[model samples]
Target: MLDDRQTRTEKLAGEIADAILEGTLEPGSRLDEHMLAGRYGTSRTPVREALRQLATTGLIELRPRRGAIVAKVTSEQLEMLFIAMGELEATCARLSAMSMTPIERRRLGAHYDQMGEMVAQDDVPAYTAANTALHAMFYAGAHNPVLSEMTAGLRRRLAPFRRAQFRAPGRLARSHAEHGAVVRAVLAGDAASAHAAMLHHVSLVEDAFEQLAGAPAGTAPEAARMKAG
Candidate 1:
């Protein structure tokens, strides 16, 4: 039951995020839990959870009296978030290279290999899931609880955008290749290489999002323009 609820919440969150990013739901649009529940044929509980998920991404604001309001995530803000995410991930990768136990490294390698199979099968959802899991391993391998916590927080903030990145053409394969670089560096215990590779991979992730959104890297989204008007 718990897993089902979480699945529903994540699915609804993804759908709502799609609407927002596609300009179907412009900035300032009201997201009434009751209406959303009806619209999506779900209970208010899931609707609320979905909205809360979106709130973490800065794609919507949950206000005291206003309930939920779609918010304009400016290009500048997006860029800054990406920049921070890249740095955090890079640091984590570097630390993981230096600190991951041999057993942990073996598990990480096996996990990455499974992702390769997902890519071969063109299983976007599976690849996305595995990709997330692989990153979590890197964070855990860092052995710095504070750094790991901070990186996880930023990752949640960018979750929506990062998930959308997989929808881009050839992104799954490209992402896997990028991971290969980082994984190889980490496996070799080359901290500097791991840092550079992970940072480069994240930069490409931002690029992938821009390409899919039809927006230049770090520019205001159409929803922002709609709000401005």
Candidate 2:
């Protein structure tokens, strides 16, 4: 039932969301409709729709007269999101540990191998992509689709601030190590350890967001490092 324009608008929305997650679209940046339309090879109508979608997800804010701008991530919001993310991921780990079958754990092991390759190469883009996959797969492994959906929504909402964590010095390497620990804990079926490890992983992000607030706004915040997985 979807028309071409509607499909295009949805696709553009996804692209914009990805850009926000990757830190290419910095927070608080104004989104000019004409420019976005030109950038995406579309008309203003589609661009507007895409912006509307981002607004609904809380990634961007639409203002009267001033138009749309990337939503500013305040310190309080950052802390709240980070804290919530930790709790949610901890719950995911606990659920996955209690419910995942041996075969599911094996599949997660393979995915970890793929992640290892990305980490070894220090390929941020590949690692980021794999990070997303690992987290999604974990939710699946947990046997709770509802929790996965909720977590996914939260991730999208906090994408910009999350990406900024990767900019911190030595964060990527530390994150890689932490991810390995999380994998081991999950594979071992240690529900408590898994929960704690996941919380620790998300706490790293909290540290990054805090450091970012101490610095000037609009500055790149990627150095702090986070294990989104």
TM-score of each: 0.93, 0.77
Candidate 1 has what TM-score? 0.93
Model 1 lDDT tens row, 146-222: 99999999998888789888878899999999999999999999999999999999999988887777754234357
Regions of model 2 farther than 4 Å from truth: 1-30, 39-46, 63-66, 212-229
Q: 109 in model 1: Cα distance from truth in Å?
A: 0.7
Name the lDDT value of residue 20 in candidate 2: 62
RMSD of each: 3.2, 5.1
Candidate 1 regions with alpha-carbon error over 4 angstroms: 215-229
Candidate lDDT values, in order: 0.89, 0.75
Q: What lDDT score goes with residue 160 in model 1?
A: 76
